[model samples]
Target: MTPEAPPTTPTQAVEIVRSRYAQPKLPDGTPAELKVHEFDIGYLVFAVFPPRTDAAGRPQPSPPGGAKIVVSKETGETVTVPNYPTEKAIALYRKNVERNA
Candidate 1:
């Protein structure tokens, strides 16, 4: 796919997150809880919850992957690297937030 323009708003960021993690909602087709946070690690990390998807495929309230987007704070800049734990990404995001604050 061709590169897209950078998102200038949190709503746009939500749209970006939903593109990959579609079908996110409750069993009754209601919207689920979603969130966006401050930027860090050269990126912005947004979480799109699945209503009930946990790390082990359990129907829990939280998940660790396939439900997050680490968009660069600037164009084409990624915070995550290959073969790293997702916790690191979160850490980096928090660090950047701290730095920016």
Candidate 2:
């Protein structure tokens, strides 16, 4: 298959994230999925968590220490940032972009 071009839209950015990261897994080996936690025209942020209740039927909070994936809308580049506030993550992305530019 041919390589995908850099994402120019939000939907394309999402697809890139999904394809780039493998499915998330819980400590017990249960599989989880990445969900879009926040998005803007310039970046998309994804969080790793189980989509439904765990095997024991208890609600699962997202695991800590899972870095959030940020997809750049302008370049299709990706960066993993600490699982902190959304605003802070965006700021870090901007800083990285500037530093590289």
Candidate 3:
């Protein structure tokens, strides 16, 4: 198998951006929420996921491995919560957020 070429032009970059931002809605017709907002971490776009719930009706932390983005619907605030898959990545993301804020 051969590798694909990198994006070469501004148009290609825009297309790539659009594709990355595209997401499918859930079965209940609730669209995948992606809210852009101002935070302590400069500007960041948040992709809101279905809230993970417990049997006791509590909101649980998001699953591991996948990226976690936190947001407040009422306040319109957002933050890209670090996905601590690896120690290095976790530290790097945290540091970047801290430095930006």
Candidate 4:
């Protein structure tokens, strides 16, 4: 076994990033922002989100302080995203995003 080729095209990289940033909700009605990529121990991808802070300068339930939704590119899974209340909710969310897009 040996190393595999990395994504060479900008379009491919962009698509990967986009898909990971906006993953569809799970079957159990859980929303996730994950990207699947080949793992490289020396390299990492960081998906940074704006901080969710209050007047008290404390972290809120939403996102985080300069939240970075760091995920394993090799595995499409994470825990920062919200869990949908139901399948209907997931469907509705996807539908709305698609329609708006």
Candidate 5:
């Protein structure tokens, strides 16, 4: 089967991620830096930075120990990313990345 075209502009990727990341179940927030970065593995990841109360409304500095995780699952095998939370969101991101990779 032939693969379809990837996103022609960043807007498509951004819009796709924005909708998924803003869902009610997951947290409602933006990264402290408020940036959506493409992962080396080809998926977009963003952080919902802790809220800021300072005059500027910028989130305070935070340590990024949670940026990646390494643990054994119930299968007793280790994985970098945990099980899928949003299958559709993940599939969309993967489809876009495959074009570039």
Candidate 6:
């Protein structure tokens, strides 16, 4: 098999994550959107969540423990981690990258 090409831009990186990871479904059985929660030069972290507002128009609290998808800009590779704060997720991704390097 051919190796995947590395992502050229942040937008491309997001696309990679979208294609590779499946968005989680809400209690209503609707698939949540993959939103870009954070990023740096090397990685883009996505949060799986429902819309910002509910049908009643109230703000939605972010779901607990939804997995975050991290995409590597250099390799177009991905890592999924438990729902963590952006900083912690990036730190874990960096550690994994280092270990694999």
TM-score of 4: 0.25
TM for every model, in the order presented, reads: 0.47, 0.64, 0.35, 0.25, 0.28, 0.66
Alpha-carbon shift of residue 62 in model 6 (angstroms): 5.3
- Give the poorly placed runs of model 5, Cα more than 4 Å off: 1-5, 23-60, 65-101
Pairs of colliding residues, candidate 4: 37-73, 51-66
Candidate 2 per-residue C-alpha lDDT over 1-101 given as tens digits, one digit per residue, 9 for 90 to 100: 12356676656766787777776677578765455544553554564554556889988675458677777655577778887788887788778878978
Q: Give the per-residue lDDT of model 5 (tens digit) for 5-54.
A: 33333344444444434432224442333233333333333445545455
TM-score, cand. 2:
0.64
Show model 1 residue runs off by greater than 4 Å.
40-66, 76-88, 92-101
Candidate 4 per-residue lDDT over residues 1-101, each given as its tens digit = 11233344434443444555564454456654433222331112333234566889998775324222223233333213233333333444346535856
- The numbered model that scores best in lDDT is 6
Q: Which has the better TM-score: candidate 3, or candidate 6?
A: 6
Alpha carbon lDDT of each predicted model: 0.52, 0.66, 0.44, 0.38, 0.36, 0.67
Model 6, runs deviating above 4 Å:
1-3, 26-31, 37-41, 48-63
Candidate 2 residue pairs that clash:
none
Q: Which stretches of model 4 miss by more than 4 angstroms?
A: 1-6, 9-12, 19-43, 60-101
Candidate 6 lands at a TM-score of 0.66
Candidate 4 C-alpha error for residue 24, in Å: 10
- Pick the TM-score winner: 6
Tell me the lDDT of model 4 at 38. Answer: 29
Error of 6 at 74 (Å): 1.0
Residue-pair clashes, model 2? 0
The RMSD (Cα, Å) of candidate 5 is 12.2
Which tens-of-lDDT digit does each residue in 4-75 have in candidate 6?
Answer: 777777677677776776756776888765566545545655655546778989998764666677766666
Q: Which scores better on lDDT, 2 or 5?
A: 2
**Residue-wise lDDT of candidate 1 within 2-46, one digit each (tens)?**
225566666665565556455456667777665655454234444
Over 1-101, each residue of candidate 3 has an lDDT whose tens digit, in order, gives 11123333334333333354456366487667554433332223335678877999899987565453333222223334565333444455458656976
